[model samples]
Target: MAGFVAVIVVVDLAVHFYLWKRLVRDVTRPGWRRTAGTVVAAGLAVLVPVTVGATRGGHLWWLAWPGYVWIGLMFYLLVALVPLEVPRLALVLLWRPTSRTSEAAETLSRRQAIARGAAIVAGLTAAGTTGYGMRTALGPPRLQRVQMPLAKLPRSMDGLRLAIVSDIHLGPLARTHHVGRIVDLINSVTADIVCVVGDLVDGSVAELGKFAEPLRGIESRQGAYFVTGNHEYYSGFAPWIDEVASLGVRPLRNERVEIGGLDLAGVNDLGGAQYGDGPDFAKALGDRDPSRPVVLMAHQPVVARQAAPFGVDLQVSGHTHGGQMAPFNLVVKLQQPVVSGFGRVDGVPVFVTNGAGFWGPPLRVGAPPQVTVMDLRSS
Candidate 1:
């Protein structure tokens, strides 16, 4: 953990330094204005780790608001400014001054103009993107009703709806009301089974437990269920496992349960292997009858490959947040086979949800927060 924190601080400091150079130093001459910008950038840089500490510490929840928002803005600013570097470089290298005196003045004026213009563009772009993402993240999750037609789905189970909710990082940013709203929305749909697919909180149960009280109110025909996500492992999986169960939500925990003649199985997150608590496909699926269609709730889409041999008809996941922040999803794709919606891995069908809450920045770009309703139907 210390090593990871060290890396984050180093990378954050480096990025902030780059942002200051491009948006501050390059745009403003050496003056108090530049000094002030430097101070602001430095403060924001330090806030990254501070906010992380506050969230993990679970004490100063209020700080998470500004800290995370700035983080989001900083990300978009970096994105917008990096590409401007290309054009700025082109101008410096290609432009030729005919006379020294006139050339020097013209060059300086042009540089200032370009720098200021680039700064303005990047600032607006970042603010707009971050603002839009914030609205999308804070608002009620987009309820997605999707059909899952399983070839072996029992005729009695036809038209069964399973509401999939994952990654509700209910800590500093998202509190009780957030969970309440989601519960209200899911209840309205009246799903056959509501699957709270892990990543329920960022802090420990003693800190964020009460915030999740709204979960007990969830209304479903069968019952609400829970499974561990990668975040759960990070937030002390054992206690969270017990806490989730207290909310009247059953934790699948590498186990299987029969519902509507369909086998519903779940495993610990694949990432848990580092803690010697990885997914046990055999325990969760091996004992199952092959003839019955099984729907697996494993937090990550990549696990589909591991569970493929067990014959998972459908795997629901939410780890990627559908690349919550745009080009970021492209990176997510490298790790998880499917970022969002239906995708096949090792010929196993996987449906990755964008999840119902934000993780770090309280903002989402191309991937809007969602609660996908898997409307199971017989193929």
Candidate 2:
């Protein structure tokens, strides 16, 4: 944890320093303007870590909102800065011609102004994008309806609606209100089965247990089933598994349950093994009727690689959050086979949700939160 914190601090400091040098220092010459710019940059640099600490400490609860917002803004600005810096670097390195003619001086000034203007535009764009992302994150999750066509699916299970909610990340930023709203929305869907694919809470059960009480009210005909996501392991997996079970939600850890003539199974998240409780696919799928189409819930999409060999009919997962923002989704794709929506691996169909909550940032740009309602059909 100390190493992780150190890395974050170093990266954040570098980004802030770059912003200060390229945008602030260049635009504001040494004067009162420069002094003010320095102060603002320093404040932002401090705010990044301070707010994060406040949130982690669970002190000054109000700081969480601004802290997370700052986090989102900083991340967006960092990405935006990459493109904006290229021209500035070129101007500094390649455009230093010795011809000091009047036209050349005027042209240099105009080009410098243009670069400054571009930096300002990039900053504003990042802020605007962050604001819009926050709105989407705070808003109710969008309902996504999908059809899961399973080969030889039981007739009794046909048209069975399964609601999938994952990656709630309930902590300082996401509290009871968010969970309450989610419960009401999921209840309204009237799903036959509701599956929560893990990463439910950021803190331990002791800290956020009360906030999660709303989950008990989730109404479903077959009850809600949960599987631990990587986040769950990070935040006391054992107790959380028990706490969720107490909430009338079933936590399937390499276990299977028969529901409506279909084999519904869930395995521990892939991260579980790092903590000595890795997913046991063979055990979860063992002793199952091969004729019965199986629906597996594994948190990360990459788990489909294992599920494919088992001939699992479908796998429901959420981790990528569809990159949770633009360009980042491209990055997420490099790690996970499917960022969001439906895809296939080894001919086994998989559905990876964008998730219903934000993680580090209280914002969702390109990948919006979702309450997925998958209607199963026999193909």
Candidate 3:
């Protein structure tokens, strides 16, 4: 853990230093403006680790707002500024001033003009994107409908709606009201089953269990079910297993249940491997009747490759948060086969939702928080 924190601190320093060089030094005159920018840059660099430590370790939940907001802003600033580097570089290489005093002054003036212009563009882009993302993240989750046709599903089970909710990292940013809002939205759907895929909370049940109480309000017919996500392992999976059960949601731990002729199976998150509790497809899917249409609920979409041999008709998952932020999804795809929406992974049809909550920064871009209704169709 120390090593991991050290790496994060190092990376944080590097990012802030580059940001300072571009957004501060290049944009400001050699005076108090530059000094002030240097101070703010350094302070924000320190705030990164402090915010994470205080929130995760010290449990200073209130600091989550300012801390995470700045994180989001910082991220977009880099995203915006990195692209401007190309133009900035081109200007440096193309503009050559001879050893004339007047020419040197003109060249300097033009350079400053371009630098300041680049700063303004990056600043506005980052601010606007972050603002929109904040609104999308903090506001109520959007309702998304996906029509999925299953080859082995019984015709009688067609039109069965499974409400897909995942990545509801219910800690400091997502509280009772947030869960309550999600519950209300899920209830409005009158889904047959509500699947909480994983990454439910960052903290333990003792600290954040009350925030999840709203889940009791879920109005599903067959029932609400939960499968462990990576975060559950971090937040004491043993207690969370019991907590969700107490709230009337069944925890599917490497097990399957027959529901209206459909086999609904769930497994522990892959992260649980560290705790000797990782997903066991054999335990969950080994003896299941092949004729039954199986809908596996594992946290990460990458599990499809492992589950392919099980003859799973469909898998519903949420771990990528649909990338949570734009361009970030591109990174997510490197790990997850299907970041969001329908895809065929190793012959198994998988549907991934954007999930219903935010994680670290309380901001989502390109992809908004969502409660997806997977309308199952028999083909």
| Model 2 lDDT-worst window of ten | 91-100
Q: What would the per-residue lDDT of candidate 3 be over residues 1-379, giving only the tens digit for each residue?
A: 8999889989999999999988888777799999999999999998888888889722998888889999999999999999998998799778777767778787877788788888899999999999999999999999999898888888988899999999988887778998898999999998999999998888988899887898888888999999999988888999999999999999999999999889999988999999999999999999878998999999999999999999999999999999999989999999888999999999998899998888889889999999998889999
* Index of the highest-lDDT prediction: 3
lDDT per residue as tens, model 1, 74-97: 999989999988998898778777
lDDT tens readout by residue for model 2, 271-375? 889899999988999777799989999999999888777879899999898899787888888899888899987777889988889887789998889889999
- Local error of candidate 1 at 316, Å? 0.8
lDDT, residue 172, model 1: 85
Q: What is the TM-score of each candidate against the true structure?
A: 0.96, 0.92, 0.96
Candidate 2 similarity to native, TM-score: 0.92
- Candidate 3 residue spans exceeding 4 A from truth: 96-99
Off by over 4 Å in 2: 1-3, 57-60, 86-108
| Candidate 1 similarity to native, TM-score | 0.96
For model 1, name the residue pairs that clash.
none
